[model samples]
Target: MHRIAVLLVEPVVGFDATIAPTLFGAAADADGTPLYEVVTCGLSRAAVTTTNGFALLPAAGPEALATADTVVVPGTRYAPARSDGVLQPELAAALAAIRPGTRIVSICTGAFVLAAAGLLDGRPATTHWRFADDLRALHPEVRLDENVLFVDDGDVLTSAGLAAGIDLCLHIIRSDHGAAVANEVARYCVVPPWREGGQAQFIERHMPADPHASTAATRQWALDHLDEPLSIEQLAGHANMSERTFCRRFREETGQSPGGWVRSRRVERARELLETHDLPVDEVARRAGLGSGGNLRHHLRRGLGMSPSSYRKVFQGS
Candidate 1:
Protein backbone atom coordinates (compact mmCIF):
# COMPACT_ATOMS: atom_id res chain seq x y z
CA MET A 1 0.00 0.00 0.00
CA HIS A 2 1.08 3.57 -0.59
CA ARG A 3 2.14 5.41 2.58
CA ILE A 4 0.94 8.93 3.39
CA ALA A 5 2.49 10.96 6.18
CA VAL A 6 0.63 14.00 7.47
CA LEU A 7 2.87 16.54 9.18
CA LEU A 8 0.99 18.61 11.72
CA VAL A 9 2.88 21.77 12.49
CA GLU A 10 2.15 23.49 15.79
CA PRO A 11 -0.97 25.62 16.11
CA VAL A 12 -2.56 23.58 13.33
CA VAL A 13 -5.97 24.31 11.94
CA GLY A 14 -7.75 21.39 13.58
CA PHE A 15 -10.26 20.57 10.84
CA ASP A 16 -7.68 20.76 8.08
CA ALA A 17 -5.38 18.36 9.91
CA THR A 18 -7.94 15.55 10.01
CA ILE A 19 -9.14 15.74 6.40
CA ALA A 20 -6.40 13.69 4.77
CA PRO A 21 -6.44 10.85 7.25
CA THR A 22 -10.23 10.75 7.30
CA LEU A 23 -10.68 10.75 3.53
CA PHE A 24 -7.67 8.62 2.62
CA GLY A 25 -8.38 6.18 5.42
CA ALA A 26 -11.89 5.66 4.09
CA ALA A 27 -10.64 4.59 0.67
CA ALA A 28 -10.64 0.83 0.12
CA ASP A 29 -10.67 -1.66 -2.74
CA ALA A 30 -13.91 -3.39 -3.74
CA ASP A 31 -12.86 -6.40 -1.68
CA GLY A 32 -12.51 -4.18 1.44
CA THR A 33 -8.75 -3.75 1.33
CA PRO A 34 -7.47 -0.33 2.40
CA LEU A 35 -5.75 1.51 -0.40
CA TYR A 36 -3.26 3.56 1.63
CA GLU A 37 -1.49 3.63 4.96
CA VAL A 38 -1.96 7.04 6.56
CA VAL A 39 0.18 8.17 9.50
CA THR A 40 0.33 11.44 11.42
CA CYS A 41 3.71 12.95 12.28
CA GLY A 42 5.04 16.12 13.80
CA LEU A 43 8.42 17.77 14.46
CA SER A 44 8.78 15.42 17.33
CA ARG A 45 6.85 12.86 19.40
CA ALA A 46 5.06 15.56 21.32
CA ALA A 47 1.58 16.96 21.78
CA VAL A 48 0.97 19.44 19.00
CA THR A 49 -1.24 22.43 19.76
CA THR A 50 -4.00 23.47 17.40
CA THR A 51 -5.91 26.65 16.61
CA ASN A 52 -9.13 24.92 17.62
CA GLY A 53 -8.44 24.96 21.36
CA PHE A 54 -7.12 21.44 21.49
CA ALA A 55 -4.00 19.41 20.79
CA LEU A 56 -3.07 16.26 18.89
CA LEU A 57 -0.54 13.56 19.81
CA PRO A 58 1.03 12.46 16.57
CA ALA A 59 1.72 8.78 15.94
CA ALA A 60 5.31 9.44 14.89
CA GLY A 61 8.01 12.04 14.58
CA PRO A 62 9.81 13.57 11.60
CA GLU A 63 11.42 10.19 10.89
CA ALA A 64 8.14 8.96 9.41
CA LEU A 65 8.48 11.37 6.49
CA ALA A 66 11.57 9.61 5.14
CA THR A 67 9.52 6.60 4.07
CA ALA A 68 6.30 8.33 2.96
CA ASP A 69 5.24 8.10 -0.67
CA THR A 70 3.41 11.35 -0.08
CA VAL A 71 3.60 14.10 2.55
CA VAL A 72 0.79 16.44 3.54
CA VAL A 73 1.05 19.69 5.49
CA PRO A 74 -2.16 20.88 7.12
CA GLY A 75 -2.95 24.52 7.95
CA THR A 76 -0.94 25.86 10.87
CA ARG A 77 -0.38 29.05 12.82
CA TYR A 78 3.35 28.39 13.01
CA ALA A 79 4.57 31.99 12.66
CA PRO A 80 7.87 31.68 10.83
CA ALA A 81 6.24 30.06 7.81
CA ARG A 82 2.85 31.73 8.16
CA SER A 83 4.08 35.33 8.33
CA ASP A 84 7.77 35.60 7.41
CA GLY A 85 8.05 33.08 4.55
CA VAL A 86 10.92 31.37 6.38
CA LEU A 87 11.22 27.89 7.77
CA GLN A 88 12.61 27.48 11.27
CA PRO A 89 15.70 25.27 11.46
CA GLU A 90 13.94 22.37 13.19
CA LEU A 91 11.00 22.41 10.84
CA ALA A 92 13.34 22.71 7.89
CA ALA A 93 15.30 19.73 9.09
CA ALA A 94 12.09 17.75 9.55
CA LEU A 95 10.90 18.47 6.00
CA ALA A 96 14.31 17.73 4.51
CA ALA A 97 13.95 14.12 5.59
CA ILE A 98 11.19 13.55 3.03
CA ARG A 99 12.44 11.61 0.03
CA PRO A 100 13.04 13.40 -3.22
CA GLY A 101 10.21 13.04 -5.79
CA THR A 102 7.61 12.28 -3.12
CA ARG A 103 4.29 14.03 -3.73
CA ILE A 104 3.65 17.04 -1.47
CA VAL A 105 0.26 18.52 -0.57
CA SER A 106 -0.91 21.50 1.39
CA ILE A 107 -4.35 22.34 2.75
CA CYS A 108 -5.40 25.96 3.32
CA THR A 109 -2.71 28.05 5.03
CA GLY A 110 -0.44 25.05 4.99
CA ALA A 111 0.72 26.40 1.64
CA PHE A 112 2.71 28.86 3.72
CA VAL A 113 4.89 26.07 5.02
CA LEU A 114 5.54 24.73 1.54
CA ALA A 115 6.22 28.24 0.26
CA ALA A 116 8.58 28.93 3.16
CA ALA A 117 10.54 25.77 2.43
CA GLY A 118 10.93 26.80 -1.23
CA LEU A 119 8.92 23.76 -2.32
CA LEU A 120 6.27 25.94 -4.04
CA ASP A 121 8.58 28.32 -5.86
CA GLY A 122 7.75 28.46 -9.55
CA ARG A 123 4.80 26.10 -8.85
CA PRO A 124 1.13 26.88 -9.15
CA ALA A 125 -0.64 26.73 -5.76
CA THR A 126 -3.57 28.04 -3.74
CA THR A 127 -4.48 28.74 -0.12
CA HIS A 128 -7.19 30.31 2.01
CA TRP A 129 -8.39 33.38 0.12
CA ARG A 130 -8.16 35.60 3.18
CA PHE A 131 -4.39 35.07 3.29
CA ALA A 132 -3.68 35.08 -0.43
CA ASP A 133 -2.31 38.60 -0.40
CA ASP A 134 -0.03 37.78 2.50
CA LEU A 135 1.29 34.69 0.74
CA ARG A 136 1.94 36.68 -2.42
CA ALA A 137 3.81 39.38 -0.55
CA LEU A 138 5.84 36.87 1.41
CA HIS A 139 6.70 34.59 -1.49
CA PRO A 140 6.49 36.31 -4.85
CA GLU A 141 8.13 33.35 -6.56
CA VAL A 142 5.08 31.15 -5.98
CA ARG A 143 2.24 31.20 -8.48
CA LEU A 144 -0.73 31.77 -6.21
CA ASP A 145 -4.34 31.66 -7.36
CA GLU A 146 -6.68 32.11 -4.42
CA ASN A 147 -9.87 31.95 -6.43
CA VAL A 148 -9.97 28.22 -7.12
CA LEU A 149 -10.77 25.41 -4.70
CA PHE A 150 -7.44 23.70 -5.40
CA VAL A 151 -4.48 23.61 -7.78
CA ASP A 152 -3.07 20.19 -8.68
CA ASP A 153 0.38 20.61 -10.24
CA GLY A 154 1.38 16.97 -10.62
CA ASP A 155 3.55 16.09 -7.58
CA VAL A 156 2.67 19.28 -5.72
CA LEU A 157 -0.88 20.34 -4.81
CA THR A 158 -2.55 22.99 -2.69
CA SER A 159 -6.10 23.79 -1.64
CA ALA A 160 -8.09 26.75 -0.38
CA GLY A 161 -9.54 27.01 3.12
CA LEU A 162 -11.58 24.51 5.12
CA ALA A 163 -13.83 22.31 2.99
CA ALA A 164 -11.78 22.78 -0.13
CA GLY A 165 -9.36 20.30 1.40
CA ILE A 166 -12.08 17.70 1.02
CA ASP A 167 -12.28 18.44 -2.68
CA LEU A 168 -8.53 18.05 -3.04
CA CYS A 169 -8.46 14.79 -1.10
CA LEU A 170 -11.20 13.30 -3.22
CA HIS A 171 -9.34 14.46 -6.31
CA ILE A 172 -6.22 12.60 -5.17
CA ILE A 173 -8.24 9.49 -4.43
CA ARG A 174 -9.82 9.67 -7.87
CA SER A 175 -6.43 10.12 -9.45
CA ASP A 176 -4.94 7.17 -7.59
CA HIS A 177 -7.68 4.55 -7.64
CA GLY A 178 -10.12 5.74 -10.31
CA ALA A 179 -13.48 7.53 -10.00
CA ALA A 180 -15.36 4.45 -8.92
CA VAL A 181 -13.33 3.98 -5.75
CA ALA A 182 -13.36 7.69 -5.05
CA ASN A 183 -17.14 7.80 -5.55
CA GLU A 184 -17.63 4.91 -3.16
CA VAL A 185 -15.49 6.62 -0.52
CA ALA A 186 -17.44 9.82 -1.07
CA ARG A 187 -20.74 7.99 -0.66
CA TYR A 188 -19.52 6.54 2.61
CA CYS A 189 -18.40 9.98 3.80
CA VAL A 190 -21.66 11.66 2.72
CA VAL A 191 -20.01 14.27 0.55
CA PRO A 192 -20.11 15.12 -3.14
CA PRO A 193 -17.72 12.94 -5.12
CA TRP A 194 -16.33 15.73 -7.30
CA ARG A 195 -16.05 19.50 -7.44
CA GLU A 196 -13.93 20.86 -10.26
CA GLY A 197 -10.74 22.38 -8.85
CA GLY A 198 -11.35 25.45 -10.95
CA GLN A 199 -14.63 26.15 -9.16
CA ALA A 200 -14.59 29.36 -7.15
CA GLN A 201 -13.44 29.09 -3.56
CA PHE A 202 -16.13 31.51 -2.51
CA ILE A 203 -19.15 33.11 -4.20
CA GLU A 204 -20.57 36.42 -3.03
CA ARG A 205 -24.19 35.37 -3.39
CA HIS A 206 -26.93 37.18 -1.57
CA MET A 207 -30.02 35.30 -0.51
CA PRO A 208 -32.88 35.72 -2.95
CA ALA A 209 -35.58 37.94 -1.49
CA ASP A 210 -38.21 35.54 -2.76
CA PRO A 211 -37.26 31.86 -2.32
CA HIS A 212 -39.38 30.81 -5.27
CA ALA A 213 -37.50 33.20 -7.55
CA SER A 214 -34.22 31.38 -7.12
CA THR A 215 -32.77 29.55 -10.16
CA ALA A 216 -31.90 26.40 -8.18
CA ALA A 217 -34.76 24.38 -9.57
CA THR A 218 -33.73 25.27 -13.08
CA ARG A 219 -30.16 24.21 -12.40
CA GLN A 220 -31.39 20.80 -11.25
CA TRP A 221 -33.59 20.60 -14.30
CA ALA A 222 -30.59 21.36 -16.45
CA LEU A 223 -28.70 18.49 -14.87
CA ASP A 224 -31.56 16.12 -15.54
CA HIS A 225 -31.79 17.17 -19.19
CA LEU A 226 -28.11 17.63 -20.09
CA ASP A 227 -28.65 15.31 -23.08
CA GLU A 228 -30.85 18.04 -24.62
CA PRO A 229 -29.97 21.51 -25.79
CA LEU A 230 -30.63 23.97 -22.98
CA SER A 231 -31.11 27.56 -24.06
CA ILE A 232 -30.93 30.48 -21.63
CA GLU A 233 -34.46 31.50 -22.55
CA GLN A 234 -35.73 27.97 -21.90
CA LEU A 235 -33.98 27.77 -18.55
CA ALA A 236 -35.35 31.20 -17.56
CA GLY A 237 -38.81 30.05 -18.48
CA HIS A 238 -38.43 26.98 -16.26
CA ALA A 239 -37.60 29.29 -13.33
CA ASN A 240 -40.38 31.71 -14.25
CA MET A 241 -37.86 34.54 -14.56
CA SER A 242 -36.67 36.71 -17.40
CA GLU A 243 -33.50 35.64 -19.20
CA ARG A 244 -31.49 38.56 -17.78
CA THR A 245 -32.58 37.90 -14.19
CA PHE A 246 -31.87 34.20 -14.61
CA CYS A 247 -28.38 34.85 -15.90
CA ARG A 248 -27.55 37.27 -13.09
CA ARG A 249 -28.92 35.00 -10.40
CA PHE A 250 -27.23 31.94 -11.89
CA ARG A 251 -23.78 33.54 -11.88
CA GLU A 252 -24.23 34.93 -8.37
CA GLU A 253 -25.28 31.56 -6.98
CA THR A 254 -22.85 29.33 -8.89
CA GLY A 255 -19.88 31.60 -9.52
CA GLN A 256 -19.95 30.65 -13.22
CA SER A 257 -21.88 31.67 -16.29
CA PRO A 258 -24.68 29.27 -17.24
CA GLY A 259 -22.99 28.30 -20.50
CA GLY A 260 -19.70 27.57 -18.76
CA TRP A 261 -21.40 25.52 -16.09
CA VAL A 262 -23.31 23.56 -18.70
CA ARG A 263 -20.17 22.85 -20.68
CA SER A 264 -18.35 21.66 -17.56
CA ARG A 265 -21.24 19.39 -16.65
CA ARG A 266 -21.33 17.98 -20.16
CA VAL A 267 -17.62 17.26 -19.99
CA GLU A 268 -18.14 15.61 -16.62
CA ARG A 269 -20.90 13.44 -18.06
CA ALA A 270 -18.64 12.48 -20.91
CA ARG A 271 -15.98 11.43 -18.38
CA GLU A 272 -18.48 9.28 -16.46
CA LEU A 273 -19.52 7.57 -19.68
CA LEU A 274 -15.93 6.98 -20.60
CA GLU A 275 -15.26 5.35 -17.24
CA THR A 276 -18.39 3.19 -16.89
CA HIS A 277 -19.35 2.27 -20.43
CA ASP A 278 -17.70 0.94 -23.56
CA LEU A 279 -19.63 3.33 -25.82
CA PRO A 280 -17.94 4.82 -28.87
CA VAL A 281 -16.54 8.33 -28.56
CA ASP A 282 -19.14 9.96 -30.80
CA GLU A 283 -21.99 8.24 -29.01
CA VAL A 284 -20.58 9.32 -25.64
CA ALA A 285 -20.28 12.88 -26.88
CA ARG A 286 -23.83 12.97 -28.26
CA ARG A 287 -25.27 11.51 -25.06
CA ALA A 288 -23.26 14.06 -23.06
CA GLY A 289 -24.64 16.95 -25.18
CA LEU A 290 -21.18 17.69 -26.56
CA GLY A 291 -22.26 17.10 -30.23
CA SER A 292 -19.64 14.72 -31.71
CA GLY A 293 -16.48 12.69 -31.30
CA GLY A 294 -14.32 15.55 -32.50
CA ASN A 295 -15.79 17.88 -29.88
CA LEU A 296 -15.42 15.30 -27.13
CA ARG A 297 -11.79 14.75 -28.03
CA HIS A 298 -11.17 18.48 -27.94
CA HIS A 299 -12.82 18.95 -24.53
CA LEU A 300 -11.14 15.92 -22.97
CA ARG A 301 -7.75 16.95 -24.25
CA ARG A 302 -8.17 20.50 -23.07
CA GLY A 303 -9.58 19.61 -19.65
CA LEU A 304 -7.65 16.39 -18.82
CA GLY A 305 -4.70 16.31 -21.19
CA MET A 306 -5.97 13.09 -22.71
CA SER A 307 -8.24 11.92 -25.51
CA PRO A 308 -11.49 10.01 -24.91
CA SER A 309 -9.95 6.61 -25.62
CA SER A 310 -7.02 7.31 -23.33
CA TYR A 311 -9.34 8.44 -20.56
CA ARG A 312 -11.30 5.19 -20.83
CA LYS A 313 -8.15 3.10 -20.79
CA VAL A 314 -6.97 4.83 -17.62
CA PHE A 315 -10.20 4.90 -15.62
CA GLN A 316 -11.52 1.52 -16.71
CA GLY A 317 -8.10 -0.22 -16.66
CA SER A 318 -8.87 -1.65 -20.13
Candidate 2:
Protein backbone atom coordinates (compact mmCIF):
# COMPACT_ATOMS: atom_id res chain seq x y z
CA MET A 1 0.00 0.00 0.00
CA HIS A 2 1.10 3.56 -0.58
CA ARG A 3 2.08 5.16 2.70
CA ILE A 4 0.85 8.66 3.56
CA ALA A 5 2.21 10.60 6.50
CA VAL A 6 0.32 13.62 7.84
CA LEU A 7 2.77 15.93 9.57
CA LEU A 8 1.29 18.22 12.18
CA VAL A 9 3.16 21.16 13.55
CA GLU A 10 2.27 22.50 16.98
CA PRO A 11 -1.01 24.40 17.35
CA VAL A 12 -2.34 22.69 14.29
CA VAL A 13 -5.81 23.46 13.05
CA GLY A 14 -7.53 20.27 14.16
CA PHE A 15 -9.96 20.12 11.25
CA ASP A 16 -7.29 20.61 8.61
CA ALA A 17 -5.08 17.86 10.07
CA THR A 18 -7.82 15.24 9.83
CA ILE A 19 -8.71 15.79 6.17
CA ALA A 20 -5.90 13.77 4.56
CA PRO A 21 -6.47 10.59 6.55
CA THR A 22 -10.23 11.02 6.46
CA LEU A 23 -10.36 11.07 2.67
CA PHE A 24 -7.28 9.07 1.57
CA GLY A 25 -7.77 6.51 4.29
CA ALA A 26 -11.28 5.88 2.98
CA ALA A 27 -10.18 5.17 -0.58
CA ALA A 28 -10.49 1.52 -1.61
CA ASP A 29 -10.41 -0.64 -4.71
CA ALA A 30 -13.21 -2.75 -6.16
CA ASP A 31 -12.49 -5.57 -3.73
CA GLY A 32 -12.80 -3.22 -0.74
CA THR A 33 -9.11 -3.24 0.06
CA PRO A 34 -7.59 -0.04 1.43
CA LEU A 35 -5.41 1.78 -1.11
CA TYR A 36 -3.31 3.88 1.23
CA GLU A 37 -1.90 3.43 4.71
CA VAL A 38 -2.26 6.78 6.45
CA VAL A 39 -0.51 7.72 9.68
CA THR A 40 -0.38 10.90 11.72
CA CYS A 41 3.01 12.19 12.84
CA GLY A 42 4.36 15.07 14.85
CA LEU A 43 7.75 16.47 15.77
CA SER A 44 8.04 13.58 18.20
CA ARG A 45 6.14 10.45 19.14
CA ALA A 46 4.24 12.33 21.80
CA ALA A 47 1.14 14.33 22.37
CA VAL A 48 0.73 17.72 20.72
CA THR A 49 -1.85 20.32 21.69
CA THR A 50 -4.17 21.62 18.99
CA THR A 51 -5.33 25.15 18.49
CA ASN A 52 -8.75 24.09 19.74
CA GLY A 53 -7.49 23.14 23.20
CA PHE A 54 -7.33 19.40 22.61
CA ALA A 55 -4.29 17.14 22.52
CA LEU A 56 -3.53 14.40 19.99
CA LEU A 57 -1.04 11.60 20.40
CA PRO A 58 0.59 10.75 17.11
CA ALA A 59 1.60 7.23 16.10
CA ALA A 60 4.96 8.33 14.70
CA GLY A 61 7.29 11.27 14.48
CA PRO A 62 9.60 12.90 11.95
CA GLU A 63 11.07 9.46 11.23
CA ALA A 64 7.86 8.57 9.38
CA LEU A 65 8.52 11.27 6.79
CA ALA A 66 11.34 9.26 5.21
CA THR A 67 9.09 6.26 4.64
CA ALA A 68 6.11 8.18 3.32
CA ASP A 69 5.22 8.19 -0.35
CA THR A 70 3.27 11.40 0.31
CA VAL A 71 3.75 13.95 3.05
CA VAL A 72 0.86 16.25 4.00
CA VAL A 73 1.27 19.38 6.05
CA PRO A 74 -2.00 20.76 7.38
CA GLY A 75 -2.64 24.36 8.43
CA THR A 76 -1.00 25.36 11.65
CA ARG A 77 -1.51 28.55 13.60
CA TYR A 78 1.82 28.59 15.41
CA ALA A 79 4.30 27.92 12.63
CA PRO A 80 7.01 30.57 12.37
CA ALA A 81 6.44 30.56 8.63
CA ARG A 82 3.29 32.61 9.18
CA SER A 83 5.15 35.51 10.75
CA ASP A 84 8.80 35.38 9.73
CA GLY A 85 8.64 33.60 6.36
CA VAL A 86 10.84 30.88 7.84
CA LEU A 87 10.42 27.45 9.30
CA GLN A 88 10.95 26.76 12.97
CA PRO A 89 14.13 24.88 13.87
CA GLU A 90 12.43 21.63 14.80
CA LEU A 91 9.91 21.98 11.99
CA ALA A 92 12.67 22.58 9.45
CA ALA A 93 14.53 19.53 10.71
CA ALA A 94 11.36 17.47 10.49
CA LEU A 95 10.71 18.64 6.93
CA ALA A 96 14.31 17.70 6.06
CA ALA A 97 13.46 14.11 6.96
CA ILE A 98 11.15 13.74 3.95
CA ARG A 99 12.51 11.48 1.25
CA PRO A 100 13.25 13.01 -2.13
CA GLY A 101 10.47 12.88 -4.71
CA THR A 102 7.75 12.40 -2.13
CA ARG A 103 4.57 14.26 -3.04
CA ILE A 104 4.20 17.36 -0.87
CA VAL A 105 0.81 18.88 -0.02
CA SER A 106 -0.31 21.81 2.07
CA ILE A 107 -3.81 22.63 3.29
CA CYS A 108 -4.61 26.32 3.92
CA THR A 109 -1.72 28.17 5.59
CA GLY A 110 0.35 25.02 5.53
CA ALA A 111 1.49 26.44 2.19
CA PHE A 112 3.41 28.82 4.37
CA VAL A 113 5.56 25.95 5.57
CA LEU A 114 6.31 24.64 2.08
CA ALA A 115 7.02 28.19 0.89
CA ALA A 116 9.37 28.77 3.81
CA ALA A 117 11.26 25.59 2.91
CA GLY A 118 11.64 26.97 -0.65
CA LEU A 119 9.78 23.96 -2.11
CA LEU A 120 7.09 26.17 -3.68
CA ASP A 121 9.45 28.75 -5.17
CA GLY A 122 8.83 29.40 -8.86
CA ARG A 123 5.71 27.19 -8.73
CA PRO A 124 2.02 28.00 -8.80
CA ALA A 125 0.47 27.80 -5.34
CA THR A 126 -2.45 29.15 -3.28
CA THR A 127 -3.57 29.42 0.29
CA HIS A 128 -6.74 30.74 1.95
CA TRP A 129 -8.10 33.66 -0.06
CA ARG A 130 -8.04 35.81 3.04
CA PHE A 131 -4.33 35.18 3.40
CA ALA A 132 -3.41 35.60 -0.24
CA ASP A 133 -2.03 39.09 0.23
CA ASP A 134 0.04 38.08 3.24
CA LEU A 135 1.44 35.04 1.46
CA ARG A 136 2.33 37.03 -1.64
CA ALA A 137 3.97 39.69 0.48
CA LEU A 138 5.98 37.09 2.38
CA HIS A 139 7.00 34.85 -0.52
CA PRO A 140 7.07 36.88 -3.70
CA GLU A 141 9.05 34.19 -5.51
CA VAL A 142 6.19 31.67 -5.25
CA ARG A 143 3.74 31.98 -8.12
CA LEU A 144 0.60 32.59 -6.08
CA ASP A 145 -2.79 32.45 -7.74
CA GLU A 146 -5.30 32.99 -4.97
CA ASN A 147 -8.40 32.85 -7.12
CA VAL A 148 -8.49 29.09 -7.60
CA LEU A 149 -9.33 26.46 -5.03
CA PHE A 150 -6.02 24.66 -5.40
CA VAL A 151 -2.77 24.46 -7.33
CA ASP A 152 -1.37 21.15 -8.61
CA ASP A 153 2.33 21.85 -9.27
CA GLY A 154 3.44 18.27 -10.03
CA ASP A 155 5.14 17.06 -6.84
CA VAL A 156 3.99 20.06 -4.84
CA LEU A 157 0.34 20.95 -4.20
CA THR A 158 -1.43 23.60 -2.16
CA SER A 159 -5.06 24.29 -1.34
CA ALA A 160 -7.02 27.39 -0.37
CA GLY A 161 -8.66 26.50 2.94
CA LEU A 162 -10.14 23.63 4.93
CA ALA A 163 -12.87 22.82 2.40
CA ALA A 164 -10.74 23.38 -0.68
CA GLY A 165 -8.39 20.78 0.77
CA ILE A 166 -11.14 18.28 0.02
CA ASP A 167 -11.06 19.35 -3.62
CA LEU A 168 -7.29 19.00 -3.70
CA CYS A 169 -7.36 15.55 -2.11
CA LEU A 170 -10.01 14.35 -4.52
CA HIS A 171 -7.91 15.75 -7.37
CA ILE A 172 -4.84 13.91 -6.09
CA ILE A 173 -6.83 10.70 -5.98
CA ARG A 174 -8.09 11.28 -9.50
CA SER A 175 -4.59 12.04 -10.75
CA ASP A 176 -3.06 9.02 -8.98
CA HIS A 177 -5.72 6.42 -9.68
CA GLY A 178 -8.52 7.72 -11.92
CA ALA A 179 -11.86 9.48 -11.84
CA ALA A 180 -13.64 6.24 -10.96
CA VAL A 181 -11.69 5.84 -7.76
CA ALA A 182 -11.95 9.50 -6.91
CA ASN A 183 -15.68 9.52 -7.60
CA GLU A 184 -16.13 6.53 -5.36
CA VAL A 185 -14.30 8.27 -2.56
CA ALA A 186 -16.32 11.41 -3.10
CA ARG A 187 -19.55 9.44 -3.01
CA TYR A 188 -18.51 7.79 0.23
CA CYS A 189 -17.70 11.21 1.63
CA VAL A 190 -20.95 12.75 0.33
CA VAL A 191 -19.23 15.41 -1.78
CA PRO A 192 -18.89 16.40 -5.43
CA PRO A 193 -16.04 14.66 -7.18
CA TRP A 194 -15.03 17.20 -9.81
CA ARG A 195 -15.06 20.93 -9.18
CA GLU A 196 -12.69 22.50 -11.70
CA GLY A 197 -9.78 23.93 -9.77
CA GLY A 198 -10.04 27.16 -11.71
CA GLN A 199 -13.51 27.93 -10.33
CA ALA A 200 -13.66 31.18 -8.38
CA GLN A 201 -13.11 30.93 -4.65
CA PHE A 202 -15.48 33.78 -3.99
CA ILE A 203 -18.65 34.26 -5.99
CA GLU A 204 -20.56 37.54 -5.74
CA ARG A 205 -23.78 35.95 -4.52
CA HIS A 206 -26.00 38.53 -2.94
CA MET A 207 -28.90 36.50 -1.62
CA PRO A 208 -32.23 37.51 -3.09
CA ALA A 209 -33.89 37.64 0.31
CA ASP A 210 -37.07 39.04 -1.16
CA PRO A 211 -38.90 36.10 -2.68
CA HIS A 212 -40.14 38.16 -5.62
CA ALA A 213 -36.66 39.47 -6.37
CA SER A 214 -34.97 36.12 -7.15
CA THR A 215 -34.04 35.03 -10.68
CA ALA A 216 -33.77 31.45 -9.46
CA ALA A 217 -36.82 30.17 -11.30
CA THR A 218 -35.60 31.61 -14.58
CA ARG A 219 -32.13 30.13 -14.06
CA GLN A 220 -33.63 26.70 -13.41
CA TRP A 221 -35.76 27.03 -16.51
CA ALA A 222 -32.69 27.91 -18.52
CA LEU A 223 -30.93 24.78 -17.27
CA ASP A 224 -33.89 22.70 -18.33
CA HIS A 225 -33.81 24.30 -21.79
CA LEU A 226 -30.05 24.24 -22.35
CA ASP A 227 -30.47 21.85 -25.29
CA GLU A 228 -32.57 24.58 -26.92
CA PRO A 229 -30.78 27.72 -27.98
CA LEU A 230 -31.06 30.28 -25.15
CA SER A 231 -30.82 34.03 -25.46
CA ILE A 232 -30.42 36.84 -22.90
CA GLU A 233 -33.58 38.56 -24.10
CA GLN A 234 -35.61 35.37 -23.73
CA LEU A 235 -34.25 34.79 -20.24
CA ALA A 236 -35.08 38.36 -19.24
CA GLY A 237 -38.60 37.93 -20.61
CA HIS A 238 -38.99 34.73 -18.61
CA ALA A 239 -37.95 36.55 -15.45
CA ASN A 240 -40.38 39.41 -16.22
CA MET A 241 -37.51 41.87 -16.22
CA SER A 242 -35.99 44.04 -18.93
CA GLU A 243 -32.81 42.89 -20.63
CA ARG A 244 -30.63 45.46 -18.85
CA THR A 245 -32.09 44.72 -15.42
CA PHE A 246 -31.72 40.98 -15.94
CA CYS A 247 -28.06 41.24 -16.93
CA ARG A 248 -27.19 43.36 -13.92
CA ARG A 249 -29.09 41.08 -11.52
CA PHE A 250 -27.61 37.95 -13.06
CA ARG A 251 -24.05 39.12 -12.50
CA GLU A 252 -24.81 40.17 -8.92
CA GLU A 253 -26.51 36.85 -8.15
CA THR A 254 -24.21 34.38 -9.93
CA GLY A 255 -20.98 36.25 -10.63
CA GLN A 256 -21.35 35.37 -14.33
CA SER A 257 -23.20 36.74 -17.32
CA PRO A 258 -26.28 34.99 -18.68
CA GLY A 259 -24.44 33.74 -21.72
CA GLY A 260 -21.47 32.62 -19.66
CA TRP A 261 -23.72 30.74 -17.26
CA VAL A 262 -25.50 28.97 -20.10
CA ARG A 263 -22.18 28.01 -21.66
CA SER A 264 -20.89 26.69 -18.36
CA ARG A 265 -24.01 24.65 -17.77
CA ARG A 266 -23.77 23.24 -21.26
CA VAL A 267 -20.16 22.32 -20.68
CA GLU A 268 -21.06 20.67 -17.41
CA ARG A 269 -23.79 18.63 -19.03
CA ALA A 270 -21.40 17.61 -21.77
CA ARG A 271 -18.86 16.59 -19.15
CA GLU A 272 -21.37 14.41 -17.33
CA LEU A 273 -22.38 12.75 -20.58
CA LEU A 274 -18.73 12.21 -21.49
CA GLU A 275 -17.94 10.62 -18.17
CA THR A 276 -21.00 8.42 -17.72
CA HIS A 277 -22.42 7.60 -21.14
CA ASP A 278 -21.31 5.75 -24.24
CA LEU A 279 -22.87 8.16 -26.70
CA PRO A 280 -20.87 9.42 -29.66
CA VAL A 281 -19.23 12.83 -29.41
CA ASP A 282 -21.63 14.57 -31.73
CA GLU A 283 -24.67 13.09 -30.00
CA VAL A 284 -23.28 14.12 -26.63
CA ALA A 285 -22.66 17.60 -27.96
CA ARG A 286 -26.22 17.83 -29.30
CA ARG A 287 -27.65 16.65 -26.02
CA ALA A 288 -25.56 19.22 -24.17
CA GLY A 289 -26.59 22.08 -26.47
CA LEU A 290 -23.03 22.51 -27.75
CA GLY A 291 -24.29 22.16 -31.38
CA SER A 292 -21.54 19.89 -32.80
CA GLY A 293 -18.52 17.76 -31.89
CA GLY A 294 -16.12 20.53 -32.87
CA ASN A 295 -17.98 23.00 -30.66
CA LEU A 296 -17.86 20.54 -27.74
CA ARG A 297 -14.13 20.09 -28.20
CA HIS A 298 -13.59 23.80 -28.28
CA HIS A 299 -15.49 24.44 -25.04
CA LEU A 300 -13.95 21.49 -23.21
CA ARG A 301 -10.45 22.51 -24.26
CA ARG A 302 -10.96 26.14 -23.37
CA GLY A 303 -12.93 25.57 -20.18
CA LEU A 304 -11.43 22.33 -18.88
CA GLY A 305 -8.03 22.24 -20.56
CA MET A 306 -8.74 18.91 -22.25
CA SER A 307 -10.49 17.50 -25.31
CA PRO A 308 -13.66 15.44 -25.30
CA SER A 309 -11.90 12.20 -26.22
CA SER A 310 -9.26 12.73 -23.55
CA TYR A 311 -11.90 13.52 -20.95
CA ARG A 312 -13.88 10.43 -21.88
CA LYS A 313 -10.76 8.33 -21.76
CA VAL A 314 -10.10 9.51 -18.23
CA PHE A 315 -13.65 9.11 -16.97
CA GLN A 316 -15.74 6.89 -19.29
CA GLY A 317 -16.02 4.00 -16.83
CA SER A 318 -16.02 6.26 -13.79
TM-score to true structure, per model? 0.96, 0.81
Which residue ranges in model 1 land beyond 4 Å of their true spot?
none
- Per-candidate Cα lDDT values, in order, are 0.92, 0.86
lDDT of 2 by residue, 186-207 (tens): 9999997766676667767667
Worst 10 residues of 2 by lDDT: 194-203
Clashes of each: 0, 0
- Tally clashes: model 1: 0
Clashing pairs in 1: none
RMSD of each: 1.4, 3.3
